[model samples]
Structures are given as C-alpha cells and as structure tokens.
Target: MDSIQMFLANCNLSVSQAMRKIDSNSHGILFLVDDNNLLVGCVTDGDIRRYLLSGGGMSDVVARASNQKPKVARSLAEAIKLYHNRDYVVIPIINNQGIVIDMYMGEGVKDKKYSPLHLPVVINAGGKGTRLDPFTRVLPKPLIPVGDLPIIELIMQEYQSYSCDEFHIIVNYKRELMKAYFADNEANYNITWYDEEKPLGTGGGLSLLRGKLKSTFFFANCDALLTANYESMLKFHKDNGNVITMICAYKNINIPYGVVEMGENGVITDMKEKPLISFLTNTGIYIVEPEVIDDIGDEEAIGFPDIIEREKQKGKKVAVFPVSENDWMDMGQLPELEKMRKKLFGE
Candidate 1:
C-alpha cells in the first residue's frame, strides 16, 4: 500500500477495520474520508477506545468513532509548521474542499520515546500454562518467544518504557529456565526473584511480597502485555483513593447467525441477526497499593479476581481502568500468541 492509503479509511468502514488500519500504520491515526475522498474526520486509537467504552459496537461505522472536527493544515507549508509546533506524529494536508491531498510525518515519528515511570513492577510468572500445551511442556510460557524476545521480557520492557526499572517476578513452573534466560541475556534488568514452592493462584504469589513493596506498584500477568498509558492509570488509582485498580479492556464479540428469543409456550418474542455484545474484561494488569498484600493469605490458591472481590466486600476502595481492545495482547493461548507476535513484529 502507498503511504497515503495506509492511513486513510472510508467513513463507512467498521470500527474493527479502522482499528487494524491504525495498528498497521504505526502512526496511531487514521483519516476518515467521504465517498468523494474529502476528509470527514480523524480517528485515533483513543477515539475508538472511548467509543467502545461508551457502548459502541465493533461493527459500527468509523464515522461514529471519529473526530468530526480535527486539526488540519491547508497547505504543505502550514502542515510542516503545525507538525513541529504541535509535535504531531502525522498530519493530513487538506484542500479548500476538505479533501486530503497529502500527509506529513514528523522526523523520528517511528522512534518515539516514553518518559520513565520509576515504579516497581510485579509479574506473576508461576502458573502452568496448560492452554499453550506442548509449547509450555518444554519452556515456561514466560520464556516463549513473542518476536525476538520472550513474553516475560516484552512485558518487562513495556514497563521499562515508563521508567519502571525494579521488577519482582514470581516463578514456580520451570523456574530455573525462566531465570537462566534472563541471566544469559545482555540487557541488564534489575529483577528480584520470588519462588513459589507450590502451585498458588494469582493473588497467592503476591503474599510473598507483603513488606517488599512500600509504595504503589504495578502487577501484571506473565501471559499478557498491555500498551495503555501507565501514568494515566496510576493517576486514576491515586485520585480515586483505590486500594486496587484493575485494568480492563472493552471487548466486543459479534455473534454470528440470527438468534430468537423465546417467550412462554415457546413463542418467538424477538429476533436479532448477528448482534454484537460488548464487555469490559480484565486484562490481567493492575496498579495496587502495598496494604492489599495483607489481605491475601500465604500459600492460598486464590486468583486475583477473588482477592479484588474480597476487598470490595470489606468496603475498601477498588476500581477498574478500561482500555481499548486493541491495546491488550493476550499470549495465553497458541492462537493468541501468534496473533500477538504478528501485531508486535509484523511477522
């Protein structure tokens, strides 16, 4: 595809299609145009996410999630000036008729760097990845390759970009292999190892660091990688006075075929064809306070979700931060692993 086509999408395109375009373009934006090739709006990953969070469906048209009035340049000189002045990664040059004639990409747009977060990150890497099957039989899921680096390393790097340097990894299944891989790597990462003697569910492993984390820290699953804004999530957690802030993704599942709703006496009351259902699902990432560690009992086989529920029961502040479906990468299953690899490395 040509450069211009890569970032252009018809207004009638589905939200999912527009998401794919934004992901592949690497500019994190898409120009929505009408049938006449006139610019109608601008769509970004954040725009789609907000649409989904607000009950928008994946099959909804791109126009429903796009900015009706986007910042634009009228000419090449104006585009260049706007690009540097606003530090924009990409800007569309439009004519008097609002038709996009060209685009300007800022220098080093592809190599943008994020500010450091300097927060501690805790990764739960102790689970036996039964879903991945044969692959997990040899190497632990965390060590499984996602592009050039292991899944665990990629998860760590996501945090490192936010300047989160200190890592606390909880390991159990094939623990040595996980440690050896990190030890052999040239990239120096500061990590603290916590060994789980037996199979402990997600929240159980956290009990080991009851006193280690004096301040707020990030907790993530080894099989998941999220590209959402960590700073914003942290701010939300603190601002809300939440003890645990879970990160969730607004996922839309489109069910195929028509469904009939039966009433009394098997009477068909309603029928809808290929309806789309939206849900806010846990993305296995969190910003947690240190005191919550006391709520978990050592060696207890309880998942993190259950822990959150218990905290809620006690009236402790617990909240959820939602991200777009495209921001989350689930590497738990073989199919998802391949999908994540392709998404991250264009494999």
Candidate 2:
C-alpha cells in the first residue's frame, strides 16, 4: 500500500503533475487534499477532460474538477472486481479521516494462482529464413543464436517472466531439428509440438491446434524480441471486452528530402524539412480470446490477421497497445541480427 501526502501541495501543480502521479501509481488517478491532509476529492483523466471540455480554466482548483466519492475496495479480489467493472485506471483507498491510505493500480496485478496466467501460447516458428541466407540454411530461424541462447528461448523467457509456462511451438521447416534441440536442453517450460507435414503459412499452422487451447493466450513470431508487461496487456484485453489485442510499437521513418503538406490548390498548408515520420507498427505479438480458434479456416494458407479482420467486421472489439521503440528487437536480417548480438553480448 502506497499513498501521497495530502497536504503537500504548497505550490501549484499542473495537469502534467496529475498525469505523472497517475502513471507512477498505475491507477490513473490523483487525489486533491486539503491543509489537514484530508482527502478533498479525487481527480481522474476523465474528470479533468470534462472540466476542460466544459470551458473550465486550467488555473481552477483541482477540487473543483474532481469526483467527490470515488469507488473503492478493501481486499484484492474486490479491487480486481472493481477494476473489471469500471474503466478506471486507479482506485484510491481512504480511511475514516478521509485521508488516502493506499492506492490500487489496475495494470500491475499478477495472478497469485496459476490459472489466469498459464494460457497456452503459440509460437510461429515456421518461417523460411531467406534473409539470413547461408546461416539459416543449416539452422532453423527459431534456433538461430541471438547470444549464447536461441532466439525462441529468449522469447520464451520473456513470457515466462510474466508467469506464462504452457507453450505450443508450430514447426514445419526443420521440425526435427527444433525438437532435437529442445530434447537436448533440460529446460522446464511445458512445450507441446504442433508439426505441419507440409509448409503452411505463418498463421495456417495455428489451425492445427484449434481444439487444443481453451483460454486467452498469446501468439508471436519467433524472429522478433519484445519486452512488455504481459499481465497488464492481458488485463487490458479482458477488462475492455476485446476479443483480440495487438501489441504495436512506435517506429520512426526518416525522410532524407524536404517534406511539405499542400492543400487542394497546391498551396503549402505546412512545410517542413526532412521531418521524421512516426507510426505504430505491429510487433507480431498478440493476446487473443480462445473462441477465435473456431474462426480458423480449414484451408492451408489462412492467416491470423485475415481471420481477426473478419471478426472485427462482425463487431468484435479489437484493441492495440503501444510499446517502446528500444524494446523491440527483430533478428530477421543479418545486419539486425548482428546488432542484436552486439547489444546482447557487448561484443
């Protein structure tokens, strides 16, 4: 249980202060306290937005833009239940004196029991590595060494950090090699094999295990290394009623030449020189509901994105969360793989 001092606002705080408090606390809420260290009211992003949208001034007192009585819970289960009920980012816990004693965050809860976090993950390890060429000719891309460890082993370790143990590796090209390597290593993760006799596209192999999984799980391409809080991602997926949640990364594309935005009559609305363009690109990581397995076609080449888009057309909620740029490492090409080796091994 952690809390902020109520009477510490000797100086005026900005909206950015509130945002920082919310983020640091992981609850998406901040409390406005009085001189006696008593809770005056609580401020949320929505509350601030409402005041701003209603033409309220930024210099107004925080108490004027807060909720009088915020929803709260005493125990962990009740807190989780409240988190599932409302879209609140944080819940404040106050004692009889109306002073905030604790704060419960919605994004940092780990499953105490094995049930929620132990979903069956699918690893798409079937891609033909033409990019790495000669090196991949002898080794499957999944088994390619990132440092002293295989690429897929590092990926599994990342998921294991978040308590995910059950894994399903989809194998096609050099399936026996992957199995033999895993058999040689005395690893402890529970991995089930899904062997494709013929070459199936990345998403097509997942259909082979359609009936094998029964809980919300994750899927990833074996080549990309991403570091993210999987528990927070899963909670976001379930709390928002989303059937599928794709993890995206902010990628910047540099323009060598000057860029300009022109209007209909060729008038330059805005002009800039070699500005960097940023966009969210898929990191090939996803959390998907179990029922989506029923949507997998019986064809040999159906892809996961195509099936997800079809579900979206049928009104299923699909969400996306962004990750940091430095956190995503793709070992698909020789140059990138070399960079990863240097970063991992400090060579």
Candidate 3:
C-alpha cells in the first residue's frame, strides 16, 4: 500500500483495523471514507481511547469512534494555508464531490523536533530475567537485543530524543558483562555505573544513588518501553505537586464468552457477550523527585510499588499519568520480547 492509503480507513472497518492503521501510519490519524470514496470522518488515537472508555468494543465500526465533522480543506490553496497555520501536521483536501483528492503534509511533519528535557534518567537493569530462562543464564535482561541495539541502549536512546542524556544504571546480576558492553561500545552516552553487590528489588536499587540525583529524574525498568509524551507527563507531574508520577497504561481486554451479571438471590440482572474491559496498569516508568530516595534504605530489597504505597499512606502526593495500551510495551518475557521486537522493527 502507498503511504497515503495506509492512513485511509473505510468507515465500515472494525475498530481494531482502524487502530492498526493509526499505529502504522506516520500521523496519529486515520481518514475514514465511505464505499464511494467519499470522506466520512477522521479518527485519531485519542478518539479510539475515548470510545473504549465509553464501553465501545473492538468489533464496533470505525464510524462510531470517528469525528463525523472534521476540519478539511476544500481546495489546494486552503489546504496549504491550513498546513502553514501550524494547527495541524497534515490537511486533507476534498473536492466538491466530498472525495479526498490529495493531502498537504507540512514540511518536517514526519521529522518533527522535540524540545530537550535535560533530565537525568535512572534505569534498573540488574534483574536476572529468570522469565527469559536459558537466555538470562547467559546474558542480563538489559543486554538482550531487541533489534540491532540492546534493550538498555534502546531505552537510553528514547530518552535521548527528548535531550535526556545522562543515565544512571543499576546492575547486579551479570554486572561485569553489562558494564563491559557499555565500555566497549562507541555510543557516547553519559552513563554513571552503580553496582549492587547482591540483588536489590526494583525500588531498592535507587538507594545506591542517594546523593547522586539532586534533581528530578526519569526512572524506568529496563524491560519496558513507553512511547508516551515525556514533556506532557513531566508538566503534569510538576503541576500536580506530586512526589512521584507513575505512568500507567489503559489496557483493554476483550472477553470471548458472554458474561452474566448476577445480583442478589442469584438473579441475572444483565448479560453481555464478549465485553471489553479497561483497566489502568502500571507501565514501570515513573518521574520521581530526588527526595524519594531517602525513603529507600541501602541494601533493602523493596519493590517500587511498595515505596509508592508507603508514600501514599504518608499522605504524600503520588499521581498517575495515563497512556493508551499501545504506547507501552513490556518486554520482560520471551513472548512480549518478540512482540516488542516486531512492533519496533516491523518484522
């Protein structure tokens, strides 16, 4: 399919198909058209999310989640003007017949630059990755290759795009190999090495950098990759007076069988077949203040979630920043790693 066709979805297409099109397209938008190739509506990732939140299922038609009245240019001149206005990255030009004839994609739209964040990133890469089995027996989880780059490098590069260059990595299992891999590589990432003599649970590793990180930093697990907007997340974190902002993903799970709702006396109140359920799941990424490190004791093996709960119990501001399920990829296990590789490299 051509580049433009990838962004075009039929109005009768399933929500799942529209979602795939949106994910594969350069722009986060899908243009919905009718059987006669007439413009019907526009669907974005946000629209699908809101639809899911409103109990819309994946089998529903794309039209139900799309904007019936969308901003479109009637002529080439108008499309150019709209594109130049910086209000949109791409403008669809429809003829009088209501058919999309062409599109005006602004220059650098696909390669848009983001402002630098200039924040330190703390990555917990010390896990033995027992779930990966024999592979973990040879290599650490962070050293596992997602594509050409290892998972740790990929994580660092993602943050580097937002100009977050400094990285503080905590390593324990296969620590020497992790350190040696970075030492031999030519990628000039600003890295500070922290060693754990023994395994420390996720949050416990942060204790090694008690005096290192004096400012706010990005904390992430080496096994997960999140494509959410870091700048927006940071803004929300600071605006809400949060001590730690956990990034969570809204996961939608579809049940295959009919679920009968039972009330008092075993009376069936309602029945819905293959209902789609949405839940907010932790993505293992967080924006943390330096002060939180004080709560973690040295050589302690506490998980990160435990720390968050403790802070909440103490009445500290702990917030959650939500992202779509598609934005977060957990690569801790074999199946998930393969899925993440295909998603990242389109294999």
On TM-score, the leading prediction is 1
lDDT values for all models? 0.88, 0.73, 0.87
Minimal lDDT window, size 10, model 1: 106-115
Candidate 3: deviation at residue 82, Å?
1.6
Candidate 2's residue-wise lDDT over 126-193, tens digit each? 87888989888999999999889999999998787667888999888888999999988888668999
lDDT of 3 at 33: 92
Best by lDDT: 1
Worst 10-residue lDDT window, candidate 3: 106-115
Per-residue lDDT over 130-238 for candidate 1, one digit per residue giving the tens place of the 0 to 100 score = 9999999999989999988999999988898898999999999999998898898898789899999998898899998988999899999999999877887888789
| Full candidate order by TM-score, most accurate first | 1, 3, 2
Candidate 3 global CA lDDT score: 0.87
List, residue by residue over 239-275, the lDDT tens digit for candidate 3: 8899999998866678999999999999999999997
